[model samples]
Target: MAEFTVNPLRFDPYKNFKFRLKWDGRYVAGISKVSALKRTTQVVKFREGGDPTISRKSPGLNDYDALVLERGVTHDLAFEAWAAKVWQIGVAPGSEISLADFRKDVILDFFNEAGQLAISYKIYRAWVSEYQVLPDLDANANAVAIQHIKLENEGWERDTSVNEPTEPSFNSTSA
Candidate 1:
């Protein structure tokens, strides 16, 4: 039987990511994307006969279809699939990637440009939960806080903590 291998993957903002293989020198012929929500089974099917293709199509979801078909140019996959596309592009140095870094980079590189303010945080949390990357919120929270702090240093701050109080409006008390 030919060797079949798959490993953790990611995509960077500059369109670089990697898919690791189990074998010592198994080169990737190509890669594909599928949505986790559509798959009923956890098993991933590898194309037989020394081919490197992932076969699993996500079901038709309204939001997913809208994103894919936007502007009459199909994005080719849902957001998760887009994440996989990032992962596919990362298949170059053959090293394991930090999911946290992936989240942050994807945010700074792609999401931020799209005018999505919370996409980074939302997607980061989802990836962390799904991949079991960080066991506790403390770790991820620290990382996110660092990101925010850096942004603040760079003059980009958004008040989200709700710790800051708003000035009370003063109207005529006895009017």
Candidate 2:
């Protein structure tokens, strides 16, 4: 198996920050951090030589599986890590228009279109530093977001039950 890592990319005023992909072959593409990890990693297989008509094979799914097996994590967690990394970028604003800002907008758009409402809403709230209602998109985001929320809620319930005291029987007469 070939090892692929992302080098910290420079802050570009005009273009998105680009990570250097050092795999078996040198394939460089400037990807937004989230796209780099989530989408790109999955379909970016093979260093060089594939037709555009075909999709790139990526280690993303493999990595997700590895993480699930190794750490017993959900795919949402794994993909979120990739998405978070993609969203983290240095910004330099030239005349109030920043590439980092543009990348963030694109990520939000993708997140919305990809049916990641909960995640997207959370990110927006955190970034904006406010508590606001999240916009409801189509069923796509609703499905994925509900899945994530359900998993998270289940995990919380499991942990809470584990820590809670069991019910005890009491005598009929209590002083």
Candidate 3:
């Protein structure tokens, strides 16, 4: 029989609920959902002149998808204040707009069962791309109103450091 080798696993399976969503520096509240960071590549193909069976393949641009987050509507309209800078630029009268006042970084952290920081992604140049409010008026059903926000960023990098938060965290394995 051939020798079988196994690769060492460094991390245990982490929970989903034990996560943090921080924009710039402070943690963004009222967040109920978030999206996973994803990357996709384009395939370019070229045919050789001499041989019909010969073909060349090359990689193209890298595309990153926007992160979607939703939360229960709260009295604190802090997100609106920040989003106005990005959305209300054309309507509001102003000279040269300052990007520093609009664009901000976002960090998504995932924790393990022990409430320790396991994996994180640092989203770069994140800004409010789209915002929507869906209010359902029903006489029989009772549920909290939820607000959705889509964040578009230039790129993101996965963080493998041991930088843990100083506050309480949770762990949920529920799907």
Candidate of highest lDDT: 3
Predicted candidate 3 versus true structure: per-residue lDDT over 8-45, tens digit per residue: 44334456787889875788887878987888888889
Candidate 2 residues 130-166, lDDT tens each? 1112224576553422211101100100111121122
**Model 3 TM:** 0.76
Candidate 2's TM-score: 0.14
Off by over 4 Å in 1: 1-86, 96-98, 104-124, 128-175
lDDT of 2: 0.24
Q: What is the C-alpha lDDT of each candidate?
A: 0.24, 0.24, 0.75
Instruction: Give the clash total for candidate 1.
Output: 8
TM per candidate:
0.16, 0.14, 0.76
TM-score leader: 3
TM-score of 1: 0.16
Question: For model 2, where is the 10-residue window of minimal lDDT?
Answer: 149-158
Worst 10 residues of 1 by lDDT: 146-155
